[model samples]
Target chain A: MDRFEYAEARLSSGESFLIREKGVNLYDGNEKTSFEGGEVVLTSHRLLWARPGDIPRGLTCLSLPLRYVVFVEEETGSTSFGFSRSKKIVLHLSQALPGKIPGPVNRSSHHYMKLSFKEGLNSNFVQIINETIQSKKWENFSPAATPSQASDVKLRAGIVGIERGIQEKQKAADESISRAFQDLSKLMGMAKDMVNLSKNISQKIRERQGDITEDETVRFKSYLLSLGIDDPVTRTDFRSENKYYIELARQLADILEEPITDVGGMMALTDVYCRVNRARGLELLSPEDLIQACHMLEKLNLPLRLRQFDSGVKVLQLHSHSDVNVVKNTALALEDQGSLTAEELAQMLGISVLLAKERLMTTEKYGKACRDESIEGLRFYPNQFLQRED
Target chain B: MAEVEWPWQYSFPPFFTIQVHNETRTKQIAAWRSLILDYHKITKHCILDTREAQRTALFNNTAIDRKLPLEGIVTILEDLARTGNAQPLDKQKHRWQIYWHTLEEWADLVYSWVQRCGMMNTVCTLYEITDGDNSADEEFHGLDTEIMVKILQTLEVSKKAELFDDNQGVKFF
Candidate 1:
């Protein structure tokens, strides 16, 4: 029979099922009852069945599985099983037996029994449970009155409790994961609403129209901060100052220092400026400061610079230009005959004015181009000297 | 407008500030130069009236409600001048002699270019400096008539060329 063919079949005292073949007959256990034929039944965590041929009246069947069944050959077995008073149960098959099995509540003397079968074994494991009825109460496993009955009962209760505890823990973890997923759905909805509000806000800022509310500004800033994306937006996270953060997370901490909807989250530079200073808020970080920071963090991230507008306009310089030496060098060459304006650079690099300026600064730092003050506006000339002179 | 892909959208304070770092400033100037050049290059026009470039939104686009003030334009012009690439035409006219090439560099390149064009011994007119059926060096693009005269005058003293004035403005003879 397939090992678990009778998994659903109940294993009662009277029930029996056909075994395709008897692989082994193990009748050595702590119990004194002995058996030799092929057929058997496991009524509970332990198996049991009527001994074939021998009549012990209502003596019921015999069996054992789950627990490690030591094959006690005689007084001499594996050296490790040495006990002056106790008989030896050779541990060879014991060693081959699977890991810890829930020990049964029992006792007995000399008759050798095999506690060999294991749980969840798809093979001969079901000779009893699959082919016969099972008593949920583990009837056949009841302890025969023994001198040490109290100690055995205590051990049994402890073992069962441990299994119960494990099941409860697993259930709790599964519940938390499911709840977190539900919260994730809610977070997505909030993000959409935030984006809409940001668009409206950005529009207002461009128009120089209306008084923005404190709450509104903070909300928008908080949203931008939320995009800190633990994955480094700029390579700055790997620099000396940020090594710690990089180890724990792939993101930069500065990115997460969002505009505080609260005073604390608000920095002397950001949250407060958005709430109080307004337009001239860029004063919080002047070009010198920005450039200094960029220079400081240059090795940290490749593309970093102090940017300028093509119209020679001074826009805020906040973005990172971690790496662009090659681009900057090319910009220098292009500056040869006709100089490129901020607009042209922006067009060429496919970056915003802010980004173009930042990159241009990186180029400047390398002496790529020089600035021109003409009616047309600040323009970049390929640093002819750097290239030609070099 | 040469679309400057701003690495970032500058929305905060000083979107009005044009940084002075040469490389960055130069790029900024070049971008403006392109815009100015394209404006004139496409319009085949001369003289960017401050009013038009600033007020008309034809040239000066107040992308963020903030128009490039005359100062902003002047600031860019100043940077270009500092880089020896361009100069101003005037206040209201806000015209720039965009040195797609620097005057000094242009002067030197012009001499060499003239030599290359087989005009080293020959005297070319002022108009010939920029406007002509010639593949001139870029340093001469939008070369101001007056500034060319000045450059040529210096060369004249150096015995590089001789000049003559005519109704067609000035001529290098």
Candidate 2:
């Protein structure tokens, strides 16, 4: 069957094509009236027409179920356009059907559609439409069963029961698969909650124990302590790797908060990673994962942030870290020592020499310290801020 | 007055690192400009060799254990040149003449030195104004010979003195 793009006809599932007649003129009234030119379509389940040319009317597109077709009729030279002859396909709807008309087409309405085909088109359309209507009627017929037919009905009934059983099993399997996906997400959320719970537990434990000896609550408490945390939860709780990393990042941030301040508010990222991993005990994180965790801290809006010097040295620092404070501290240290190298600064600040170098350079740039370059490397002394009495 | 002290930031290690951000770089460049000009003035030095400068205490901070690398020093000097505070002499930009005092300031100093020594309008050898016996009490005394010539050249440009290229002498107006 030829399909028209303008036709809004929907073929029901399993409905097959029958006939498509173009240039069929439709006239609801008698002959001598103008007609609308369009294509007429017929399918196993529906009959539809779409006006090819622009037509000024209430309904330019028509669709009705095949079941509503009452009969097909042929009229001689009686079309509204005074065509030589035309075939009228009359549809008697048993119930109201939705069409291009504004409201539902009335029930029991007789729709007279005339198709004027030249030569052999009318005959073919009439024959096909009649056969379709008859087949549809026969499909709904319930014949009185003879003895042989009764046995065939019982076999068909048994086959249908087995098909239904299979369908039920498939539906159950689909439901379980969907449920499993939902369960997985829920478990992920629970893992995150567990991290929080563990931290809370550790906090409570520390609060309650004035000075509990290492012998009591050794496994759980020691695990918490190993993570450099007083939280009740440890790294082993989360099943998913990503969730575990996120928890580690949070714990690392918390653990470093105090140490960073004590170490002059910043420390090399490698040093931080090593200390954090050591605190986490056997569950050591790779460098990439540690870097990712630090990045996650920024996204998580934690108080700690990562900074990379133009020299490509990466460090983790508190958001409140100020270069001024590091300069001040360096000046204080230099007050007594007069001048010290990176090694001495690292020792005084209790930070890595690399970190000390970074801070000292910043302090020097601030002009609070002056440097003395020698074969032994560089050392700084309090410049403008601290006066050295000879 | 006490010696001009460096602000605390000069000892910062990040200060040695090249600043990538524009705002910080601008501030760093300014800080470098002042430091270079001030140090050169105090030391009465003119040319700054990049390699030698990096090895000096001016670029190295021992207290913080940091030294501005050669490349970083070059960047700072280039910034100083851009601001007209220093002039790069070599095509490769390895050597720089730091303009601690502008040509006008040098002219003023030399012209005043001539007046103070009662040598105004006198044709004096370029070497005499720098190393001559009478030049001792003058501020331009013992100045770098090339710098003193350049200062006399400035005085010539302003029509305050005439240069006798044949004898390498200058006649002050």
Poorest stretch of ten by lDDT in candidate 2 chain A: A96-105
Q: Write the per-residue lDDT of candidate 1 for residues A274-352, one digit (tens) a residue.
A: 4322322211233343334434433454222233334453322233422454454446545553566667766775545
Model 2, which residues run further than 4 Å from truth?
A1-244, A254-267, A279-282, A301-304, A317-323, A385-390, B1-173
TM-score for every candidate vs. truth? 0.26, 0.38
Worst 10 residues of 1 chain A by lDDT: A1-10
- Local accuracy of candidate 1 as per-residue lDDT tens digits, B58-78: 333355443455677777667
> What clash count goes with each model?
80, 41
TM-score of 1: 0.26
- On the 0 to 100 scale, the lDDT of residue A312 in model 1 is 54
Q: Write the per-residue lDDT of candidate 2 for residues A198-308, one digit (tens) a residue.
A: 778877767777566556646667665655444423447878777876877788788889988787678888789788776654345789878877878887888888888
